[model samples]
Target: MPKQDNLSGYNNTGSDTSVFFLSGIPGLEAMHLWISIPFSSVFTVALLGNCTLLYVIKTEPALHKPMYYFLTMLAVINLVLSATTVPKSLSIFWFNFREISFTACLVQMFFLHTFSSMESCVLVAMAFDRYVAICNPLRYVTILTNSVIAKIGLAALARAVLLTAPVLFLLRRLPFCQSHVIAHCYCEHMAVVKLACASTSLNNIYGIFITLFIGGLDLTLISLSYVRILRTVFSLASKEEQLKAFSTCFSHFCAILMTYTPMVLTTIIHRFGHQVAPHVHILMANFYFLLPPMMNPIVYGVKTKEIRDRVLLLSHGKNF
Candidate 1:
């Protein structure tokens, strides 16, 4: 149960708490239609691209390897992340429906953060898969078997839930005496926490701690895995073999860069960029959530010959 704060002056009690107003973009009310155009287009492409990636992986037997399996998991996480935030964002833009119920807001916050964290974990797992394939080819299959892949996916989800569940509890305890208008598009953790009249030091501390430890630790492991992979690739006698092995990791590396760069910049902006305009923060937050999902499929489809050929085959009315 949440520890309710004193509400003597505020008109609303616990039962009377109402919806929160999600401001889509702080100062661009008139240009919402224009904004919706690009946002809707990106959402559509992300949906189609990720869904197609999943379908190709499912029907193509050649893509049943561990790397593709991790790719499938990545696609699913991207879908969830985009689905949870984009529709509501579009609704806010198109229909001016910006009111999110308090409970629903919390649910959205939970799922968005959960899947984002899961995506990070999946990327780390994919890095490990690449490392094994390049540096220890003899044991790749034995190491990342079907059962082990399942366990990795499960662990990713479990880690996300464990880290995000406390945020909902913490939000519930805070007394929202200030205006309920959120300055961003969605229910971001810090955005919502900032609205609370009560002390938010614990929430801020925990959020930063989880972000640094989970995200930082995952990134460190991925970097180390790639370092080993590159070292092994360089040791190969033939230049062709080195290029072939490194090519396999290029798409995943791009995906990581897309994911973490925006995330790191947005975190820095939020914590330190006090003089920055409100709309800038909102736009950066949107990029942090939107860009990776919109680009991941395109990256893999263009970079991976197997997926590209399968997609081309499907497009030409041939068997995948």
Candidate 2:
């Protein structure tokens, strides 16, 4: 059995605390089981879908290109993000096991934020791949070689680690002299920080800066890359060629919208939706984290002919 933390000792001071209580969904105690049904379904789909994506990409030699390599990284990050949050959420919803130790919460916060940041970086890398393919087809192979792709993956990992380290350090220094009941499904940065007794202005400022710097910058670059890609696509002479180029980007565009739109919405609600119902906040947070993982594989499976063909072949019991 997994080790469980005891929360009986925690009080208003939180000085000698060992555990934090995760309130699954505030004021929805009677319907916790009902809520678990949908959450469980989504988590199951996310796990199977992302695992299938990774397996197909690994087995198919045709997927060894730079675009699919970046996709593999995206799948890994999605798996990590879902795995980090969903199991604990289900435990809370179904079994009423919500006492998470302080150390465990910090660890969860680190991986959750790190994987989220890495996903953003992976999307930017995908955008760059598409930009090169559309704008400079001749140099696509030369520019995004295996070496370059590996470097981009490493850089994404490094960025996540370096940027999130300070947040963890600051959290460690704070004296959490308050109720340790986290009123959400998972351990989020702001949610956890808000439980601290001391002023969190610096933490808030740094958090905002990182959000804008990493996520904002990545989104801006992706937009700019697509702008350039659009310019290049429009310059093509044949209508069929233009459609072909744009079709290749349709899946990625859908993915970007799904991943970022909910994120932006959730951030806005977290910062400004003080009057919003607790369940509304929790639902949006769940959507922001869960929807992308569950949807990305379906998007790619439908949009990409190669992956679609492979999936069909595997389902029919032929060699993939």
Candidate 3:
């Protein structure tokens, strides 16, 4: 297996394996150690904060509503998202070993995008939960019962798995006889697809399909939910009451902002910002991956009164 077809400079890696080398942040290898500072810090915070959020939501009966249940789904997604990429990235950053088996790379890409889609789905669910809570407060419980929440979760899992399955299948059929050096920290879908020697028109089409499925479909639905929510909030007679109603949605709005802003911005830059530095694009793309998981718990912990109080009690070593 002459795996060094396109990677001439990396002759030290030899030329007889089915592995890919993860190039940690193009044009920023020297700064990997310094870069690890923020990555390590954010990854650590993502783990602790999401774990705490899960613990608080599970143990505190008051925090078990539809909003919090949707939040629990988000927390679990964050844990998986960060766990999938961060440790592998840290290995590249700290140990400088990037030999991921071909199968492992595909698995990494699978989990990364699958959970990313689920994150988007969970966000849409949260937005709908808020819409019902504000728009139909009288029937909120009746509408989003425990069984409905479980069904929503199952639907999210099904959608994610089904939508992402084709991308992996498409990639497996391509011949990766080109350079196996995957630029960027993770084996992102398009990044791996680009390594194929064969024409990737099908893989490209699948990439666009999943991107539209996630970025297009999810955003439209979330937007629709929030628009309805805003209409409901503004219909209130008192300004104070309107503000109070909207406040309940503040944390979810923050989650949406963190989750989508960087991704949308980076996608734009990638499509149009040809003059921009490569590292800048990679940093922006990676930002969307880590920021949401790390900030979700913090935003919810501060904005939601119930989660905040419980988190505080736990911080102080007091009984919940």
Query: After superposition on all CA atoms, how large is the RMSD of candidate 2?
Result: 2.7
Clashing pairs in 2: none
The local lDDT score (0 to 100) that residue 24 gets in candidate 3 is 79
Q: How would you encode candidate 2's per-residue C-alpha lDDT over 115-222 as one tens digit per residue? A: 889999999999999999999989999999999999999999999999999999988888777788788888888888888888889999998898889878999999
Residue pairs clashing in model 1 are none
Per-residue CA lDDT of model 1 for 96-203, tens digit only, reads 777788999988998988998998999999999999999999998899999999999999999999998998898899988757777778998898888888889999
Backbone clash numbers for all candidates listed? 0, 0, 0
Question: How far in Å is the alpha carbon of 135 misplaced in model 1?
Answer: 0.5
Model 1: residues >4 Å from true position, as ranges?
Answer: 1-16
Q: Provide the lDDT at 210 for model 3.
A: 73
Per-residue lDDT of 32 in model 3: 87
Per-residue lDDT for 36-103 in model 3, tens only?
Answer: 99999999999999999999988999987888889999999989989999899898788877778888
TM-scores for all predictions: 0.94, 0.95, 0.94
Best model number under TM-score: 2
Q: lDDT of all predictions, in order shown? A: 0.87, 0.87, 0.85
Once fitted onto the true fold, the runs of candidate 3 whose alpha carbons sit more than 4 angstroms away are 1-17
As a TM-score, model 2 comes out at: 0.95
